[model samples]
Target chain A: MINNRVFPWLDERLGLTTIYKTVLDRMVPKVNWWFTLGSATLFLFVMQAVTGIMLSVYYVPSPDKAYDSIEYIMTGVAFGWLIRGIHHWGATLMVITVFIHMLRVFFYAAYKYPREITWTTGVFLFLLTLGMGFTGYLLPWNQKAYWATTVGTSIAGSVPVIGDFILRDLRGGSDLSGVTLARFFSAHIWMLPAAIIALIGVHLYLVIRLGISSIPKENE
Target chain B: MARSGNVTRRGFITSVMAFAGSIMGIVVGLPIIGYLVSPAIGGRKTDSWIPVGKLDTYPVGVPTVFSFTRSKINGWEKTTNSYSVYVLRGANDEVKVLSNVCTHLGCRVSYSKDTDTYACPCHDARFDRNGVVLSGPPPRPLDQYESKNDNGTLSIRVLES
Candidate 1:
């Protein structure tokens, strides 16, 4: 009832009808459920945001409390284990979906022609997702996180001339300490998420603007 | 574009999208609500009997300040808190412990033998030997700790909110 009465009135000013027609109501190419991966990846990102925010409620970024805080979330807080489980798995699944979605586009030649920019953005999204995984992996401050990050940064330090700068920049110093944890946490929750969200906005706008590509047929 | 009597291509796509979107919503919606509100609703109280020292160590008719460290779990970290209290020894083996925290702005209050009154350096709030507010802007008297003596050892029951 509210939609029938209020939608038209609001749509006049907001162009809701125009958006619906152009964005959702337009005819897309006939495709199978493989087309759903893009949407699925988007859904997983939303899940990441929800669960990540919930985790941040109790998560401490400091070296002393980061591990214990996660322990507290897993054991003490109600439904915290479930939220974190979803986030952890959702991140893994998102990487898979985005990668497969890119493959699907490549196979169909959907990245050709007018979709070049969209394809470029999609690649960036894939790399950013991996970046998210990398940054997020070190937040728990356990033996795994500490050693893995230590080895990971050391690899960067092995690079040519600028290796030392890269390693120091990543760790916030020569060693992994409270500052390193703080930096990773900031990137995990803030910097990487911002980049991903902005890229996603561009990705979706292009998807809607150019319309999804159709499955290729035998050439003449 | 043909409707085929009822459903169009656009209509079918919209419905399927809606269904899938709702599935996403239902999967993560409920648990996230419970997760976000869990900490705010669940809080634990800490209380203990903190021992001061031998009862005779505090001289009679004078208030002596004693401070100690109290550690408790604040979320994921163990936070150490400093708490000081004034121990007053009255006649007839009566012992009263008043929190050294000023009732006005939470500054430490010290006992001045010259004025014979507890003085808060922050706001110059003064209290009598009994810890009743005497002057300045303290709306209430200094908070008292329930104390007892066991074998000449004085301890106070501390309840933290």
Candidate 2:
């Protein structure tokens, strides 16, 4: 065990006093499963970041070579197939896990009153995850991928007066092609990630500040 | 009030224990999660030349079946699988390799000698020797591979979709 010697100036201004720890002790329940979801989500996010980086190293986002590049990984590159497979399944798993975590929070009525900001941030994060999945799906530009995006963009185009504009913005043209792949790649690898990380940081800070919700009064 | 206060103290201690337990759990569970979720994130590489066999063995103007085994490590674990492709030598002397799986839904297609086109028995889809979609529900051309010639051997790398 490592010894932590209290430094001279450390305990003064930052309130290094264990008072906050005591407050957390008084508020949080001991054996509740609801509390596990937050950490689990964080775990999955870290896994996503690492695996996503690994995949980006070999993934070609260009239209001409994207399909072939993926095939090369599957058939020729060292452990490339497995890496791609893991990234694929990992995404599906993240979606499932995030949804389940949301449900847990909802059922516990953890989103009420003081936690409104946290809940709202969480809802945004959830949507971002879905968007990430959607954008990432088209990067392969395979048959399933191509048609799926076509269907997805058509749905976007169905959203009343502005739908066509949204579809055009997404596709960068009338049809899904090279421009669209690059757009999705940028959104998947950069834009969404930046947004999600910032939102997650806020969510966690709020959680730490407010503490996990106390069980609804009579429910115990 | 004394009993209520004691109960609160007990609850607090339990929360602390739970947090500690969760930290341990995360340590143990992360690698498992990593192994399971790593596949879909990366784009696949189909950039290398895969050997299809001898140039002489591939008779001119006929489709010949070729296959190779691919094994890869995902995380620390290794797995292997077999992939097959159909190759045909055209009159122009260019060798073409096409995925045998039908483009519509992945059923195997065959060469109809009389028609000189590849036909999918399941869907009646037809493609010329080059795997071009001649008719039916196939939305695009048959998937093609990048071909290479090695010291009298004709090899092709199947590009992944």
Candidate 3:
């Protein structure tokens, strides 16, 4: 249903060729399979975002319904299990790939000169990924989630100066309640994701603008 | 062919990073699991104590049935459950509050002045003034509530399971 001329018609104003040259048509030193981890992490993040959005359709943030809604999603909705399964496992895989990608960059000394900001953003992204994991673990409102959160919040309370404040702020009260669940849900679904997206945008732009790092040689 | 379970230095570092990464994940991620269902569900105390009446209003040597209704907002729906407890007042300001439902089959038990026992009509089960089982097919004694008397006012804690 689309005209063949549609692309050029838009490209003339959009400077599609310039973007392609800058982003896709760059030259880089030879590298091995380790370089693929970065792209793999990107792919995993995309998968998680898509699957996570699909899950939010049926997920309820309230305490009473939170656990039951997850059960219903696993059993009641069509292909819901598969979607959640991907989201759950994708979170794990994303963390792995991101870590490996960071190790790769570190070993390659890519963070030395021009890519310091890239590494910084990557580190924050890693922390954000963990943040996503932490916030997401409580969504099911299961026995393990409840006790783990209790112990976890208590551990946070062990901090010296602002420890009590952090624990109370994280829990939203003296005890874990629906208020806490609501707080975590918003951070997991909105705040963390928004920050991750913005950071990813900057990281990718840097990766594109400054090209991938080259492999090192022995005889300097 | 290389040996299985054997890794180079790079592979070794990778595995170490993976392990360390998982530990860091738990340390950071576990705490984010902050707010649980609600503190009211499984908590030390609940605001579910119902005020029955003045302590002196219940006559000594007889169990007085105090009935109350509670409306709770459970998620999306409003559920109201009726609960009743028998307040047994004795000499010297001693008070024993017991759930009026029979322990055997949860059948409502009424105080029978004729027999001087709490009787369940569902079966011929009976409990004496102290709520110990007297006769019939009841398995255990009647359930007792935790009651508190503050300044002549009596209240009982009811945890609906």
On lDDT, the candidate that comes out on top is 1
What TM-score between 0 and 1 does chain B of candidate 3 receive?
Answer: 0.68
Off by over 4 Å in 3: A1-4, B1-161
Model 2 off-target regions past 4 Å?
A: A1-27, B1-161
TM-score of model 2 (first chain only) = 0.86
Model 3: what TM-score?
A: 0.57
Tens-place lDDT per residue, model 2, B7-110, is: 68778989999999999889646654554454566745655677777877888888877877888654323558667788887776678888878889988888
For candidate 2, the docking band is: incorrect
lDDT of each residue in B45-138, candidate 1, tens digit only: 8788999999999989888989999888766777899999999998877998999889899998888999999999988999998899999999
lDDT of each: 0.90, 0.81, 0.84
Candidate 1's error at B114, in angstroms? 4.4
Give the Å shift of residue A177 in candidate 3.
1.4
What stretches of model 1 exceed 4 Å from their correct place?
A1-9, A154-165, A173-177, B1-30, B41-47, B102-108, B114-116, B119-126, B135-139
lDDT of 1 at B157: 97
Candidate with better TM-score, 1 vs 3: 1
Best to worst by DockQ, what's the order? 1, 2, 3
